[model samples]
Target: MARPKVPRLSADRIADAAIELIDSGAPFGVNALARSLGVTPSSLYNHIDGRDGIIELVRGRLGRRYLPELPTGTWDEIVVETMQGMRRLYAEHPAIVPLLVGKTITDDAVIESYDVLATALVDGGFPDDEVLSVVAVLDSFALGFGLDYASPDDIWQPGTPTRSLGRLIATAERGDARSDRVFELGLELVLDALRLRLARLRDD
Candidate 1:
């Protein structure tokens, strides 16, 4: 009788399995991941530090795939590009957002992306005290837009005829196009506000 060929298990394999499990809206855990990988729970510890490790691995995978290396450009350009990329990343893996936010980010690649954003804001005249606040605003804005992007095409379904939003929903475009327009408009508003803040800081 031929022996069974067990699939090789590694950190990357663990990460991939965890992502698929999360993407499927399944409850994720070391046992769940190990089962998905056809391995014993103890076997997983050989490659990861357990739950937190798995989360970081998933984050790294998503980051490498969707996050950008902020390019040489104006601060606004850097921010727009970074935010757009972050939104796409989360939009594609909305399930991972909750997992990621619940932990302190320890992934080097993920940290580097923020480092770039921080450097750009600082170089662009934002004070050290305000750098993280700016980053937080951008982070929250991108995550919100990302969740919005993942939402159903029909954002609103008015059961009965009424004024205001119901009427607007009747004619408004649904899906990606509408979401894209709103996201861009929101970005513009944010950027304009940041510019005003920068000007005020310099004047003060």
Candidate 2:
């Protein structure tokens, strides 16, 4: 009798497995993943071209889940909503947050989502050249904030257990109003500055 042939895995299946592993806080490595999937490491090549391909697939999945059609609203409202959405998505997939911060936008879905926001800014009288710069600033701030918020106790190192924000705050001397008040004040200041810049550009 002939030996039975193994089933071939599709790229989507491999990507799905990788995502599940990452979301479960497992270290995403080829050897371990191949073992988990009951295939040789070489089998992954039939699915993903390489590690970068895997990263792109993961990013695509994240973008699909998080980057919905943004609502038609004022620029500030859109920014706030986009930031909130990004924060929620990053929190759910903390393992991939670092990848998001360091990697370039390789996934088409991710790129398109960003383009939608940039187009909105351009339509709102912002210059085309500055739209992407503004978006980069806003996205970097949101990602940094989300990472800090999600991993409050982690001592900025890999393989370390994260600390709770409450514990860290308890060490500080209690005196002034909420720290978040300061954050809100700073946000308002930035918005005001942005508005002034827009006004000056329009006047010119």
Candidate 3:
């Protein structure tokens, strides 16, 4: 008798199929994906635990490919470079914007990147606890900007302006400027606010 044929299914392969569906701008529910893969919905369980597992796989890929390696320059340089890298990543994987918005960064690759960034912030004078807060702000801003950029409503808008200062001017004229400058300005404002608070702490 011939040996039974084993179904071809793996976490990576399943993730790839899901990503392809996402790329096509189609819904990526388990049933639709199972149909596309020519496998029963239960077959996916052999590869991934469930929908969350598939989402984790996608998030892992997105983080590894998009998160920038820590920069070796000034703290400001590292911050700017990292933010720019994130912006580019979201631009390339627009379909994954929602995932980026609320996804937890539990993947080792993502955690390592966060560690590097957080370490940089600590070295730049932020308290360890504050580093995570700063990271959260930057990540949120980058994701929000990417979503705005990728929206069909803004597809016809002019490209994001290059110069940071020029962004404010471009936005005033109805052009969608890059959010890096705005983010930087916000960071500065936060730093100023922190400094004031710290001063009060020291005075007390």
Candidate 4:
């Protein structure tokens, strides 16, 4: 028996299509994705559970694509590297960032990434109870930076504003440079604080 010419649907293919639609700022769903693949909405269920499944698929894709190789640097160095990769990956997929921000992530690779963070902190002398706290803080910083990177250049457009506010807006750094400088400084400050805390705890 000859198979049909249409491509067989799968989770990866659906994730790719969804990422494309998201990149183009088009609204996507079961019907839209199926249409893109030349299949009916119900056909989508055969491969993917629904929209949430596809989102997790994409999240996993990013996890694998940008997940850092294990590095031999000190814990802080490794953390900085991982966070940088994480931020850039999300920044690259700005259209999908909003959709993912509030969802509870269940992707294995994503979870593994967090595990890696916890392990690094433990190795760096973070108390077991405090390891996840540092992980949470770094994750928040990187994700927030990702969203900031996706923001429009004109974040403020006051029709009639005060001169100080106007001067501040006029002089603020724009684009990736601004985001990078802030991220670097913020990460460094965090690492420094953690280093100090660990030293104090060790002596106690």
Candidate 5:
């Protein structure tokens, strides 16, 4: 009789398994991930730094997929492109978005993306002291919009006790179209403000 072949476990493999579990709406846990990969929970730690490490690996994987390109062009262009990519990635994996916030990003690939953004902002006239604040705002904006992208189309009810909200909801567009419009408009407004700030700094 032939011996059974065993598959090898690696960081990438672990990340893949985690993604599959999350995509299927299964709660992510060390034991669950190991079981999905046909291994024991202890074995996972050998390839990853336990749960937090695995989550970063998963984040890197998703980033490679949706945000593979290094953005070029003007600072606004770089910021816009990177933010759009983040939004798309988080929108696709809405469950993973919350998981990302708690962990300090250690993955080199993920960090590289941020490094690119930081470099671009400095080149675009933002002071070193303010670069991180700008980055945080961009990140927060993307995360919020991404979650919004995943939310229900009919967020507002038709008949509300408050007449004004009901009236406002009536004119709103439904579905991803609505989300897209809002994301674009919000992004434009942010960029406009940044450009204005840069101009003011130049004047000063």
Candidate 6:
């Protein structure tokens, strides 16, 4: 008896290869993935269903990346932490950002994360009817921030720098710190807005 020279294909391996393509902003082709794995496209079906199945694998991978546990903190604090976590996750996998937001939720890990978020909002004084909307808003913030985080430092450029533009460039030029600063500042502004909403609910 003898073993094959090439490594055997598995679902995770396929998903990993697919992720590499996406993270590099390359086109995704099942045949390409199969070739990369040194296996035939039919072999991929042995461990997973097909293209959609592989996507679910990637989704679950991300869902498992972060703990769905809502930590003990004020609603604003919880939201801030949650948004930051979401941003980091998507930023790490920039290629998947677009795919993730568009796909349906079948993976438990992702669903669990959303459930925790919903629980946080409901307990934080958000109305039941509006919880989903609030969740959607947070999603927008995290997704948008993820894209912004990957952008170049000179997002804003003027031919001749004005005083205000120079100041903007200075702040934006902090390299990695710029992303952190921008995200935190936006989170604070959003939390403040949410506070006003909560107060109005109390008033009613």
Residue 127 in candidate 2 has what lDDT?
Answer: 95
Candidate of highest TM-score: 5
Task: Please give, for residues 1-204, the per-residue lDDT of candidate 4 as tens digits.
Answer: 799787688667888888888888878777888888888988888887788888888888777778746444788888888888888887888788877765789988788877777888898888898887788888888888877787776777788968687888889987778888878888889888888998999999
Please list the residue runs of candidate 5 whose C-alpha ends up more than 4 Å from where it truly belongs after superposition. 1-7, 158-167
Candidate 2 worst ten-residue window by lDDT: 173-182
Q: Clashes in model 4: which pairs?
A: none
In the range 83-118, model 3's lDDT, one tens digit per residue, is 667777776678866754566656677677667777
RMSD of each: 2.9, 7.3, 6.5, 3.1, 2.3, 3.0
- Give TM-scores for every candidate, taking all chains together and pairing residue i with residue i: 0.90, 0.71, 0.67, 0.83, 0.91, 0.85
Better of 1 and 4 by TM-score: 1
Model 3 CA deviation exceeding 4 Å by range: 1-7, 68-73, 151-204
Higher-ranked by lDDT: 2 or 3: 2
**Residue 13 miss distance in model 2 (angstroms):** 3.5
lDDT string for model 1 (109-193, tens) is 9898899889999999999999999999999999999999777988778787777988788788889999899999999999999
Candidate 5 lDDT over residue span 25-129, tens digit each:
887899999889888888888888888989999999988887888899999999999999999988888888778988899889989999999999999999999
Q: Is candidate 1 or candidate 5 better by TM-score?
A: 5
Model 3: how far is 16 from its true place, Å? 2.7
Q: Single out the weakest 10-residue window by summed lDDT for candidate 4.
A: 64-73
Candidates arranged by TM-score, highest first? 5, 1, 6, 4, 2, 3
Q: Please give the range of 10 consecutive residues that has the lowest summed lDDT in model 6.
A: 63-72
Model 3 error, position 114 (Å) = 1.2
TM-score of 5: 0.91
* Residue 24 Cα positional deviation in candidate 1, in Å, after optimal superposition: 0.5
TM-score of 2: 0.71
lDDT of every model, 2 decimals: 0.89, 0.70, 0.68, 0.81, 0.90, 0.78
Model 3 RMSD, rounded to 1 decimal: 6.5
Reference-based TM-score, model 6: 0.85
